[model samples]
Target: MQPGLKLSQKVFFLVAVPLTVQLTFVAMLGHLLDQAEKEREREGRARQIIHHVNQIHRIIIGYIAGVAGEGLIGGGSKLEQSYSLRAGFDRELPPLQALLADNPKEFAHLLRLQKKAEASAEKLKQVKRMFKHGGDLALAGELPTMKLILRDLISELEAILSEERLIERTSPKIQATQRQRVRELLLTGVILNIIISIVLVFYFNKSFTNRLAIMMDNSIRLGLGQRLNPPLSGNDELSHLDSRFRDMTGALDAAARKERAVVENAADVIFSLDDSANFTKVSPAALKMWGYDPAFLVGKHCLAIVPKVDAKKTMEALNKVKSDDANNTFESRVVRKHGEIIDIVWSVHWSEPDNLFFCVAHDITERKIAEQVIKEAEARVRQILESLPIGLMMVTLDGKIVLANKTFEEVFGFNLADIEGETIDSILVDNRS
Candidate 1:
């Protein structure tokens, strides 16, 4: 959310924050599962302790009943069965104690149960000693007392069983609590993750999407030669790109203005022609050079203004420029609006990308007249030199004969045509050599 954050930073924030939250959620779920596992283990141990205590109570009851029934039938108590059952109690005690060790209250009950069993075992030993004398009546007299002692032992075990059953009953409550906590944790984690994703997406959409759209619009506006939007805020890359784009737009605008100014004020006609040699653009100088408005001539074939005599030459120049992709300069004549024909020296360059010819036409009518005048003066000077010639010859400083009068050529028996541009030494060869 901070300003000037780079795109990568924003992405990291979006990704890393959710990952951290998810990891925390996973850790919480793991802790909940561990607690649930411990509860289940405790419940299982409680069930085992309850089962063991009930088995001990059943064994003591059977032992007392068997002894009483045998004495009623005039048979002495079986010492083997008495000792065997006592041995069974001994084996069951250790396991019950181990099962209840984790629960202090249950274990204390187990301790009381253990003391009762030891007392019951000692009384059974004394009863068995009476049985060794083989008197059925004496066995009958001791039966009720033994039954009473064994009943007390069974009562102590019942207390232990009741405590274990109570623990087992509470298991469902603990499991229900665990299930509720699981649902809450799952719902909370899911809601939190969804909210975070939505918030990050919303922020990025609000922050980036609009700016990107503006940038796209700016591109279209710049191409249309329209003003651009203001520079974007912040120092991020997108903003920096926008700043650079604006600067480029400024440069292009300046260049376009300068080109327009030059075209408007130039003395020579600067114009462009398409592939078909139609005038695509004509500068204001078309008026000064050919007495026609640029707007009137634009979109018209260039041959319309070119004199019929020079149209072939103009087409040749255009074709040469197009085929060679090079610049060409030629002298051509164009008819003005006032029925006057003027000499124009056109310098044309071909643009391959635009498939157009960019041309500059300079009026060369004065230069042509001046060249004609210089030719006439040279003829007059030669006529005067021929009339007064006394066998005269004119030579350059390099000793190459430039001219010879008619009289001089006749006397030397040499034709001026033969000796012209030749060194004088060719005619003056020495016989001594």
Candidate 2:
């Protein structure tokens, strides 16, 4: 809407766009880092498996050589050789198989290797049982079978070890390539954001900021009573605004001239009073009517102008206006500058924006005197009606008494003030049901 405000919004979008991109990149990088770490852990486990299998193969070879060498020596115990083979197999196989279960690509191969090892260990256990039997017949049947199975186990373990080595060699390079691809995607997104930001900044400066600045300048010139010299060549909102401001300025000038004429020449004493009941302005007519200069009455309390006898009534009228009623008008008497009391017809209404009572009043001394004469004549008629010789009552076309004399008031036990304007049904005919 405004030039400076548009610039601020552009700056905010610029900052916020880049910050969001950076956050997204950071989240992606964290995910890639997590994947890399998982691959490294798998590689480490593969290496450990290879190392343990190799150790198991070396122990098997040593056991076979020891059994053959000790048979030639005629001194080694069969129990000692059997215990060495079984203890080494138990220490290595089960837990390694459990760890390998997580790697689906390698699990089938590892499981095959595990079954071969278990078969060899089972043959070694049978050979140990024959040795415990302690006869040449028991040894002859189991030792040859155990040696062949152990050799097969050694070959399977070497094959699995070679596969683990291949995985270890390739994993790091794959991780590095994945990281590079992620960085490239992130870089492309950042470049797109920068280009869009440049376009947005251009639009903000050219379309919004410049146009809004021109509007404000035109408005300020109009406010200072200067002609609008807008460069209007296009069917744009700014052109429409410039045209509207020109129209408004012309209307204001005409209204000011009209008000000046009225203030200078009006017959009524038009004035305004602040909320505290003090006068702020008075028309020229006020000076002529009161025989006091208008300046002498300005800035005086409105109550001070009224006679003491009517001061409370004037106050009541002012209070009624502040209570949110419609336009209020009251007639009151005021002592003029010449020390003579005058009757004025006064009207006052509240204006919220100025926090004041706008009032207009004019002298009505002749009309007030005429109305007093009329009231006296009506009172004389009432006196004549009260002193009637017969039961005379005046009723409207409807069967209701409108005017009642003294005899009527006595008959009804109600005064004229009580039932004078009331409907016939409201006042009982004879105080009966």
For every candidate, C-alpha RMSD to the true structure in Å: 3.6, 14.4
Which candidate number would show the highest TM-score if scored against the true structure?
1
Give the poorly placed runs of model 2, Cα more than 4 Å off. 1-23, 71-83, 104-114, 122-148, 182-193, 220-433
Cα error of candidate 2 at position 392, Å: 62
Model 2 vs truth, CA RMSD: 14.4
> What is the per-residue lDDT of model 2 for residues 1-433, given as tens digits with 9 covering 90 to 100?
2333434565676677767877887887778778878888878887888877777776677666555444434334463465366677677777667767776655666567667766665665556555656556666665678667776776677677777888788877877876786788678767877786787677666755676687787778868867666554344455566567668777988997799689869888888999888989888888887776778888999888799899999988988997864588889988888789999988888988788888899889988889999999999998999898655567687756688888877776778777776777776457576
**Candidate 1 wrong stretches, greater than 4 Å:** 73-85, 127-159, 180-192, 383-392, 405-413, 425-433
How does candidate 1 score on lDDT?
A: 0.84
Q: What's the residue-level lDDT of 325 in candidate 1?
A: 93
In model 2, residue pairs whose N, Cα or C atoms come closer than 3 Å (at least 3 residues apart or on different chains), thus clashing, are none
